[model samples]
Target: MDRSLDQLRRRLLIHCTPSQAHTAAEIATAHDTGLVVTGASADTIAHRLREKGFDGPILCDADRYSGPRRVDGGRGIRPAWCRRQQELGLVPLTDSGYLEPDNWNALRSILRVAALQRRPVIAMLPLAARWFAESHAVDDLARELDSYGVAVAVAIEHASDPFSVQYVVRHFLRLLRTAQVPVLLLRSDVAALGALCHGAFAAATGTTSSLRHIYPLTSKGIPRAAFPAVFIRHLLSYHRLDTCETVFARTPETSHFWLCDCVVCGGTTPDRLHDSDDQYSVALRHSLHAQLLLHDEIFRHTDTPDQRASAWHEACSHALFVHRQVAEHVPDWRTPAHLKSWHTVTDDPLRGRAGIPAQPTQRSVLFERPAEKWSAHERRGV
Candidate 1:
């Protein structure tokens, strides 16, 4: 709580499970941001980090996926275990419960305790929640939560459809930004880019598909498939070309699809992404690099609306161009049709608004965009 919210500006924090604590720490060190350890095993992760000689700020998140009634409504107090961890020097964050409009009272109860303890509260608002989908409901929710002074973490629950995910992210950003709260987008890599463009403090996605994509807390775990692909931040999608042969044959050489100059993948082609025995590690590193790069690019523009609008425009155009390239080059690529929503926003920025088009337009511009084509090599100055 002592840290100023402004410190989150242009920063990227990696969210991980207990098992991924070491990798998360490395990513934090590489990106120069704090780490957020979540899941039922977070306490174990905190202990492991301490044992491993990690000396940095660690946010211990209580997993709220068990049952809403257990911890909702003042019945769910901060566990003694979490309190002990906090005393041991880990910052405590609430488990991200699937909060709906009706659950405001429960959230209020949780925030009250955190405020009393002077803890920096992390509120996870699921986009699928009815309250979050409506502007008026969101406005009311923001007004209520603003009193507690907590940071917002958005979770998009298991949205496989690209357009639905992007729409939810954009709408949530627009509504939440009104509260002027420091927002962190959870999962959804493409939406995270859009969040930053709209002035979110930070955004997070996991190293694996399970980590990168958000699913319902109640859903059963699905088996993961090994797909070696490069995450194209500009396009807000992944290119699933596992082997060098696949990449070379599937994508045009003239297209910059195979290029990346991140320290993890420097001078490497997209096909090399599958060369690693640990494809998970490779994907995580690349995802982190893409996020940090996008954050830096958007951060370069000041907090002014006009500058943000320009940045949004530039990002959307690049994403559209890249999407076009992919569709033309790889006819079979499953590009989400909703990807065009970014262009629509770019064209009107104020598509749904009815006004003189002066102040509102500035605010609306932030929610637009789908992807970009900027090569990591070009962006990294390689």
Candidate 2:
């Protein structure tokens, strides 16, 4: 096992489909990361990338979404299909369909096939499986997967609440620490920041609203109306209103207060996000830029575990400060309800320890100094 894979710092992977291949290629040219191509059109995407001369590392996923039933009835395309994808110089991943506690047999079969074919697999462990499993069970499962040497990708099937999301991520990180393998948090969105802070290898989100938002397990993709929205870099949250007019009407002062420094929206007002003819592309570009910035910021202080914990603690403090700012400045601006819970749970002194006590109001000042200036006071027992 590569020791670097186990020591997660900050890595971002953009998730896309064949329809967004051109956009993905564009982003890949700018960012220093790979892309995870999902959906039933994996083959098409592979071919498109080849024709477009995209030579970046590409990890192909078989499952599009989690659901009650497997996307393809627990049986992905035939071995021939996998062979064809590999022939195109794309890494073929096993279709570890919607992982659940009761479906270990199905997951085992997927891993077995991947091992037989001598391919490194990407396993999707559902949120429920992590939440319901005991610590020993999680540890044992991680140990069992070490033999296959596959990269684990977590699918948060149900994280509607902030506290639950933080707890689940903490649990998953603990489990992955034992696995000693590369891990990816899939469809993590803003929560990807938390995953990076907790030492996951990589985190991914989509280009559009439907792709960014986590929904219940479904065989079919849900169609959602897209609106122009700005991703607040400091708070690590998205602010979406009914329309551009509404966003402008509500956030003129707030926009001036918290300007985005990302290249995509630098020096421009937040309301200008909707001014682009291609709003989705603009939003995606902003998001990708913001993610890379956050990753770099976290990576700067990751020399040791203590240093990393201090940096993460500072980040949590900054997130809390921004959360409070959003509440005060943009009362009409809606943020994820789970954002507060995530802040609360991560700030707990006894987090990841047994018998977690009642959440307390975090009093740590926001991180404003340079990364090198962080000291013992910021470590927070992490």
Candidate 3:
């Protein structure tokens, strides 16, 4: 229940949907992972997780931004609801609507409302990938965010395309460099690892694809995929379990590279991932554990920015090579664009090599609290 700033920093926050609550709770018993729940299920889910031995930081996200074109109808998110979330021993959030290029006024209103909370509130800034990464007003947005002096987490909604994924990582690194405040990446899957290596304080990803990326919602309903994909840790991306099964079935010799030795898998082969009724849950757990492993690798070299960037760069380079080996066997399978994009972004010589001080330390980016000052609220779980 000691949710201090030090406890929150350098953690791979797992965003759990209602369905993923129990599985996440089970994992919480062993791993030092943070839990992020939606506003509707914050209190009940937090209590459930606590009963199951999840003693890490719990954050409530105000799920107001569904897509770039969608706007809050003014009824879904209320200030009183946010205050109630804070009162429930969970970190509250600002009800920020999706911001476009011309929606600076809306951002101002969101910040103003967050300022009224009188506590540490996470301000959500959701925007289209291109607008967030390629727009000229990125510095303006950063200035406004710094001026407000609040913890802001940004999500690049609907960044399924390759170009957007490439720039989103670049833009996140740029914002983290220029912004005076903490710039946390939210709802990112593998991109979260890149953000942390480039000097982000915190990053989050969802258990399922629907929770991982933000897409447009329709009047009919939100589109949900039928099955969870397998997370190939060496490749740093998710692949279809069926596809993995085929690959292992066709080319059994390559099984050595794709097999997972995590506690959930216990050295199980990739083809056996779909062998049980709880296949979806298995895949979800494997993905979470794989991501946490990647996060640990990046944080292991946090002593210097060069070492951190070099560590991630080496991972990406090896992933790309593995993709080539996989393609030679499974001719139909191709490497995901984001993997290539991440490698390319880090390949820049100026990224983590030059013009940066050696003594400041990446530890400075984290928000640390004195143990004595936060002792009173430790029992409250905030």
Task: Identify the leading candidate in terms of TM-score.
Answer: 3
lDDT of 3 at 282: 68
Order the numbered candidates by TM-score, best leading: 3, 1, 2
Predicted structure 2: lDDT: 0.56
lDDT of 3: 0.66
What is the C-alpha lDDT profile of model 3 across 1-382, one tens digit per residue?
2254346666778888766776665554445668777546666777777677677777766567774345653322357756766666666666576765556677777776776775666677776665555645677778888888877777776735322366766666778888887777777787777777777777777787766777755575556667668788767788778877876677556556665555555556554757756677667776776677556545644567666776677667777887887788887777888878778776634355343223221112211211222222222221
Could you tell me which 10 consecutive residues in candidate 3 have the lowest summed lDDT?
A: 361-370
lDDT of 2 at 214: 46
Best by lDDT: 3
**Where is model 3 more than 4 Å wrong at Cα?**
1-3, 67-70, 73-77, 159-164, 217-223, 250-253, 348-382
Q: What ranking emerges by lDDT with the best candidate at the front?
A: 3, 1, 2
Q: Write the per-residue lDDT of candidate 1 for residues 1-382, one digit (tens) a residue.
A: 3464444554566767777788667656655566667776777787778888776566665646323232333344464644766666665555545554467666677666655654555655544444555567777867776788777666655535333434454567666468756667665556566556566676665555655554444554543556656676546666664534453565564335445545555545545666556666676667666666555555554456445555665556666665666556665655554456555544434343222122221112221222333345323422
What lDDT does each candidate get? Answer: 0.57, 0.56, 0.66
Q: Estimate each model's TM-score.
A: 0.76, 0.76, 0.83
- What is the lDDT, from 0 to 100, of the residue 326 in candidate 3? 78
Give the clash count for model 3. Answer: 0
* Pairs that clash in candidate 3: none
